[model samples]
Target: MLDIAKLAGKIPGISHHFQQEMTASSQRLELAKTILQQAQNQQEALIERYQTWRDRLIFSAAMPVEPLDTRITIVPPPHRHSVFATDGSQIAPSHHEIAYCYLINVGRVMLHYGQNLHPLLDSLPEVYYRPEDLYVSRQWGIRTEEWLGYRRSVLEAQCLADMACGWVNPPGAHHEPNLAMVDGSLVYWFLDGLAHDARDLILVPIQEAWEQLKAARIPLMGYLSASRSVEGVNFLRLHNCTFDTPNCIMNCVDVEEQQIPCKVIEPLRDTTLWGENLQPGQRGPLWQSSARILELYDEAQRIYFCYVNVGTEIARIEVPGWVAEDQDLFNQGLGIMLAQVNKGFGYPVALAESHNQAVIRGGDRIRFFALLEQQMIRAGLQNVGTSYKEARKRGSIA
Candidate 1:
């Protein structure tokens, strides 16, 4: 147990330190805003400069797809439309458990607005105990937890895609404008540093799902709430670099070694930059991601994102290249998102419902292990037993 009195005694010093940090952050924010305004005015020139120096920059930044200062108000969604969303939770394989297995539960939701059809909400849970399922390559040092996480993400996307495809080609011959949403980034950033074969194992399935959505002409979105992404801020730093021919590694140092000149606005995130400027229901310009991992993705599957003010918080909305390139679909998708957030009272209702369906509480985990052990015993597996540490943890002695 924590000692509240001891923690209380340290509060003043912690507060003082936080206050100083906030002061510094405020200064940086001002500088960031100034640089943003300047970039907006010279949008064309900045775009050219970005195009010229993009290959030389070491950090990932946003590549503008629209005018830098563009801010579009959210149009009301169509009277009749559908939104499908999916979220996932997992029970990672634990060494202390009786069984070396993991389970992934994907919550699926379909909501129809201005239609009589009832919302569809359900979950699909799958357990993997086989050696092949439990390990990608034990010899390669790929941890089970990491592989499970990647598999979970892939399952979520695949489930969402399956639902959207079914909705698009229903048996009744009735169709409506629809959007598919996932709770987080679509980019497989976790594939970084993994071997090419491992990357393909994950990306292939996701890309197939993405292809299905695209082939059906269904728009898919990845919603990130309170995003701390610095892609946009990094772009600003690139623009603010004073060197005639900017080379990050060679020219970033100053004589006094105080700070990198271009980093005057250090620590400001894309959220802070947009939250300060974007009004409720307004979205900033679309920007393509410069992540290195995206090189592995098909050209049409590349990610593009924009920041939107959803009244409660700044949200980062990402879409595939196909969606971004299609103006009508992009507009429709954005409007649908805004409407969903408004209806949900500041967050996407579909995502929230799906999350509720996906979340697995601690008590549920305990019960799962207990059930597993019981089933093993019934199967005549007398060797089944939890590790000593796990047994002690269940009922600790005072």
Candidate 2:
């Protein structure tokens, strides 16, 4: 390999790109402080303007408002409640390996807080190797690993929904509250990038999960830690800018050129903005997402989110519009999340446990390969060889 030490030594020698950016960093922080102070000064007017936009703005409208409401207090979760979470892990397809197959494993945990703190857990793995699964049409021209990832997302949601629906007692037998949660945003982040044909394959399963959860009224949610989304800041900009046009170039013409726009907010991420204000167990106001992907969702299933102080960090919790619009369910869901965080010490215990179950260790991969190779030999196939590059890496001692 080329000398990494020499490359590291060269990093500090670069000044042209680093110096001006460092200066800009300081300037941005100062601007953010100013924006925060201004937000405090004009809170009422800003909320008013945000409401006006919320009522009139269409899906085609630009920079929709995402208002922040800090006027709230934490409530205790129900004395007897159950929480469920699911997470998935996958071993990507390896061309260098024996079989042209990939494995998707899903882990699920259901925790009951009442009646002696009972817990249930499970893990399931599926492998795919059919010709149709191994290869897609020539138009897409992608690898099997990419397609497997799409399948994996759908499987994770299905696992959670399956666990939720398994609770047959309902209101009569259980005599307790129930909530289901996942580890990320409800919206499929990759959906917007997929072709219509590929998108349909992934969307059907996730939508089926949503339908099952809704029918059961289990109050499903998605929790994201350290989110870098800036939807909240975009809302603040809508309030700041005077331009009525959806495609305003004022920021580009003024801010980039160092001309100082009439009003600027330093482009704060939602997590950062809410981080400053939310106290432990407190949650910010619910904000409807302006993501174009939401248009594909049914009216009741549109996603909304809020930032909550989970003690360790400000995490964004997303829910369907049905959950958001229902006052009782919304409060109870937040209560359940806070309780989960409290029990787990800043994170949800169910999520943590499920992730631990889903993780595939290095040893596990080795064991899997050994089993596959043995099977291949028994089936009268030979020459199971790794790529030359992988072979070198495995044999490298230094």
Pick the TM-score winner.
Answer: 1
Which lDDT tens digits does candidate 2 get at residues 1-398? 79998898787758766897677756765666566566656666755565565544332212222344454667988788988889989898877776778899899898887669658888889888888877873357655777788888889989889887887335667647778899888877777867778777888778888889878778889999888787766555544555454234433453443443423545446677677778887788777786787777788888888888888999998999888877777888889988988888888888999999898999988898889888888888868767787678778677
Candidate 2 TM-score, C-alpha based: 0.84
Give a tens-digit lDDT track for model 1, residues 1-398.
79898899999999999999999999989888888888887777766777787777667787888888888998888899999999999999889889989999999999998888899999999999998888765655788888888889889989999998988876775467889999889777888888878888889999999899998888999999988799989888767878887677567644343466777886788998888989998999999998888999999999999999999999999999999999888888999999999989989999999999999899988898889989989999877888999888889566
Residue 178, model 2: Cα distance from true site in angstroms: 1.5
Q: What residue pairs clash in candidate 1, if any at all?
A: none
Task: Estimate the TM-score of every prediction.
Answer: 0.96, 0.84
Ten residues in sequence with the least summed lDDT for candidate 2 = 57-66
- Model 2 ranges off by over 4 Å: 1-67, 137-139, 168-171, 244-246, 249-263, 385-389
The backbone clash count of each candidate, in order, is: 0, 0
The 10-residue segment of model 1 with minimum total lDDT is 249-258
Runs in model 1 lying further than 4 Å from the true structure: 253-257
lDDT of 2 at 164: 79
Candidate 1, residue 104: CA error in Å?
0.7
